[model samples]
Target chain A: MGAMSTESDPLSVHDQVVRSTYACIARFGMAKTTVEDVVRESGLSRATIYRHFPGGRDELLREAVAWQIGEFFIRLADHVEGSADLVELLDRGIEFARQAVREHALLQRMLVTEPDRLLGLLSTESTKTLPFIAAYLLPHLERARAAGDLRPGVDPVDASDHLSRLVLSYIGARGVVDLDDPAQRRDLVTRELLAGILRP
Target chain B: MTPEASPDVRARLLDATFVCLARVGIAKTSVDDIAREAGISRATLYRHFGGKAELLEALGQRELTRLDAVFAAAVQDCATVGAACSVLVVEGAEFLLDHPVLGTILAIEPTAITPLLSLGHADAFLTAAAALVAPHLAAHVDDDAARLRGAELLVRITLSHLQSPNPQRSITDPQVAQAIVDQYIVPGFVGKSAIERIQA
Candidate 1:
């Protein structure tokens, strides 16, 4: 364990705890991870973690999962920043998200060994995740509306929320659409995902 | 113990499994409990299913068959894609939300149920749902790909709402479901002229 410095920055302390907790979960697993593991990984005292998170282990786990989801969206937002239109934006966003999930070793492992833990995070954290996703897509939808690319009378807020839900579903589940094939991805985006919001 | 495995006995065992799952959580339910619930001997249960995993798989298969029948019945009377989709969304939401076993599990141990609906296992669920609903949609949607895409979209949206229902828009409400159908589902499957005609 590192020395307990006199650092009084609450934000930095919170960040360190969360990052350490994520690492612990990635290494040990959600069900088996404990406060001791986090304390050891974080190089922080049990008192410090309890002070920051009054709820202790449960609170730390929630925060860690939320932090990971936040990091994912931040990367996704950056990847999908600039696009020609809504279709391209959706196509890229879907592809990027699908690929990211597939390549996430920790997530895949968690899904196999401890699905309940991961599903619990998703269902509870969706309250935060959905709004975050909607906010990320709202600007693009608004720009599309301004460019006359969107259907008349389609509200950008509603459209963004709708798109966010679909994108989240597609990312989690690989239904009929073969996202690996560029042609299928484009067809899905144009004909189904964007059909309601975009102008013909 | 019956030497031959009858379809009726298999259906009975699956029904009993749901009863046991509803009564106790998945982790607590066992083959003995399921056999007792079905009023059958342990030998008969083993004769039907090799073990718990096989029994659960059969339960999942049974649920899908029932869901397909529900979807088929829901859209049998509709003349247009928009009308059929509206009925499907509302009816589908109500069916999933009001299922006794799912409601009990969700209330008691959501972690036990959420994985099957989303995350790693959701792909098969969504694929099966789409396949079941696509033929009904094909009657109205002219394009083959559009029909499948529309069916999958409907399933995805419904499942998403069931997982995290919107405060502003409840899919079980007919007016709200119709609004979603008109704004999101209908346009994707049909053209602008058809939308106008359907609305008119």
Candidate 2:
């Protein structure tokens, strides 16, 4: 693979190393993942990997975690795309996010065995994450407002931030609404989650 | 060591644990330090709590109970959901952000604290907190289920802010809290027309 990729695009090489690091962390756990493991997994030489990631293992790990998170959000955005209105958008987004996290094997294992490492990564990333989510939802919220679905005096920026925070919170922990139950999930999105922002 | 520990002694030990935790953090706090801080023997501390884990768990419970009382007092006389939410957000932010032990722990050993405030481990805390705050919200909402959902949403948003406070605005600021309550929270429980009435 190294021989075949000797002349590969630089970005692809960087992506290969990051992908390998993610796999290593998933299989060996964060604490045990090493530079050598990433090299072996990616079938790349130490010198090549070092050349791609100047900061070596630490940089590789950070980038890998970040890349995976970005991918997760991208997938989530795609999953909830084309919702007719704000209510449907939130309903689909929240449900998709919950299911994805619950089904993610690495996240599940980290939750049980290495919560600190996982949470540390998330908390540090959250500074960027919240704003990104809010930005993504802003247009949809505005559309809802234009459609006369939003309550009076609901600014899209504040409402986007509000919705982003609430969604993130629900994703982190189970609350009163059971997303697994369809009826409850609908009620959560419509009657409760969107109540203050939406028109009666 | 007394076989039956007095409630006073138990409370003192928990208080001491908080001090120790603030000074040395969760990972470094020792039984001897807690006992010494409490002005009690190790045996007496043991009589009150089986171990550090049990003591910490009890302390968590006590803190929640205390929070319930504080929340009740803060929102007791509010005439509307909007007023209650403003008081709740401002008061809750002040309570958590100004807490000596939590403030210290967040500063010195955030990684150790992040897990407890994040996913998996945060479920129990979130549930209890939502339950404690739900009744106050019930007075303004239509039914029991909506009350619970609104309470949980509010609790989650408050916690999210606590976990990762916005750089631009502090929730502890009354004006910011009120803005958040008006824009995000009150609308969720009270419908648009009612919100207009309240605003008017």
Candidate 3:
């Protein structure tokens, strides 16, 4: 196959590598997403990947994860921005969150096998989504408050961090979902989210 | 194996668990710990509470009940959604930190952190906390959405803070943390009351 880059290549050589890495992850996850798999999926030789990325598979995965993180955040922000009500904002947010937790095989692998290490990742900014939660929502809270929609005294920024960590916790539930009925488990999560704040 | 006897035995075992927790903490406080602390034989402890998991749930349930009482009190006077929520969330955090038992639990058994972080049963705490917020939110506020989302965020950040090697231990000021939260999170819920209210 011969394709020209002309100006905008929707998927680049690097992009293909990243995508292939993720494809392998989809099949074998972060641990098993080998260079051979990437090479086979990508139609690129292992030598070529090594030439580009000396660090090999871990480096490829790091980039893949970083790219995935950015894309996921963008989508999540769009969901948050689309809603007005506090409840709705969180609802959409959780939906995106559920999807992320359900789909991200690598994150799940880390959560299951290496929680403390994952927690350490959360503690720092290398791969944390916590830092962005407030930054994403502060504008909306301010806008809502001015519109008299937001109740008095709610600190939007602190609330964001507070909420970010909470959602992460939900997404990180260990083996409970994999071992149980996935849909029923998801419903239980949805129920907990809604029921947790329902008025008596 | 009868349900009635099982629960009673579970209760007695959990009560004994508190003594073990107080003395050794959750990690070191194994099945033997409960047995020895309760003056019950090891076999009896196993009969009621299968192992660490069951012991943890029993303890978590007890702790949730304790939190429910304080949380209900904190938000009792919330006239607006903001007041009802802020007061409740902060008070809830305070209660979590105040309970040496919880601290002991976390310190003793770090993985147990997952129960609150990942499991659905913890919604009891979320619901109790939301009782404070439900009144102040817009009448149309989605209870299901808000509680679920809020709990998700709240659980992660609160646990992170608690588990932090050194969280903001000495600021003695919510305002500082509030500023962080506002610059970061509030705008999503209230459109700009915090920023707009300032007279130029």
Candidate 4:
């Protein structure tokens, strides 16, 4: 839950390294962030950092990205918490996802400062992120399906995968619908997402 | 590559770009590499394109043009826009996934391609797709705007699927891809009555 484990425990060195790598990504973007940068931020020596991540800076960076995305999903779940209306909840959740991706410290930095680095994170690296996100979304979709919100014969797994793909599409390319308009956003969900997957 | 000098010049440059991208990838792929592969000097390459950026843009344009033509041909024989929508997504997904140039670039260096995949280009892609699909939709839908709207949503959904395919389901699966078109895309263009009639 915490970004960093307490420094009092030396055994939490891996967490410290990961936290430092995250900070370095936020500050310098992923392309420029080096193992030395993580070492400097975490106050760990090069030997210790290398011991934790034998693959070096890229390994550390990937772990840091995973950590950041996990934190992001937690915050998103909290934001979409307690909504009784499934459509509204989905709309809000998707909007939150869009803003979260657009404003993510690392993603924003990469888009503005080091765009080439952002590509791998979105493309191939997405092999990891997409499944992770779908897993996070599955429970909610299953709940909706159980409530008879989804169409008959619609698999919850498929729906969740579809939703995740939809969200990623928005992140990479804005939809034709205006996301800024709550009504339009709701229309997109009801028409594009819900109608497509839900009972007609 | 083509008969006319201008067309030949463009085709050669794009082909060379694809070759370089397939071989060395986008980051290491320079104008010089493309020129060398095309059997032309850098000066000749420059005469055709303003710079590397322009060349890259031209390649993107050529790719889209080819895609548009494919979609047009795929949908031309369909009796209904709803049917065309189904064929378009399935065939389009196949084309994108099986495309040597696109698949190779996305596989080897997705990071280099992300910038071009931004929201700014989504509009262009949607518009191009709509232009090809609208004629088919127009034959079914009375309202021109409604036809265009349906095509836009269809393009949006297809693009999302192409970008982030379900890990479990194959994009090449006709059953799954057809279901997406049936559930999501068709109803927007054809009325519910028509959909039922078509399905029946």
Clashing pairs in 1: none
Question: What docking tier does model 1 reach?
Answer: medium
| Candidate 3 error regions (>4 Å) | A1-24, A30-67, A75-127, A136-200, B1-12, B19-29, B43-53, B72-87, B98-111, B115-200
Where model 1 places Cα greater than 4 Å from the true spot, the runs are: A1-7, A112-116, B1-12, B47-55, B190-200
Residue pairs clashing in model 4 are A119-B111
Scored by Cα lDDT, where does model 2 land? 0.80
True contacts kept of each: 0.82, 0.75, 0.11, 0.43
**Residue-wise lDDT of candidate 4 within A96-181, one digit each (tens)?**
97787766655665666765555555444544566766776788778878888777677888777776766656555554567767
Candidate 1 chain B least-lDDT 10 residues: B1-10
Sorting all predicted structures by TM-score, with the top scorer first, yields 1, 2, 4, 3
In candidate 4, stretches whose alpha carbon ends up further than 4 angstroms from where it belongs are A1-11, A101-110, A123-127, A136-140, A143-147, B1-21, B26-47, B51-53, B117-164, B188-200
Ranking by DockQ: 1, 2, 4, 3
**Candidate 2 residues B49-153, lDDT tens each?**
899999889998888788888888988898888778878878877888878778878888888777766667768877877778888776677767656766776
Model 4 chain B: ten consecutive residues of lowest lDDT: B114-123
lDDT for residue B191 in candidate 1, whole number 0-100: 53
Interface RMSD of each: 2.0, 2.3, 9.3, 3.2
Tell me the TM-score of each prediction against the true structure: 0.87, 0.87, 0.48, 0.80
- Superior by DockQ: candidate 2 or candidate 4: 2
- Evaluated on chain B only, what is the TM-score of candidate 3? 0.59
Specify the highest-lDDT model's number: 1
Q: Model 4, B72-163: lDDT tens per residue?
A: 78877878666677777777777777777777777776655554555444556667667666665555677676677677766666666666
lDDT of each: 0.82, 0.80, 0.55, 0.71
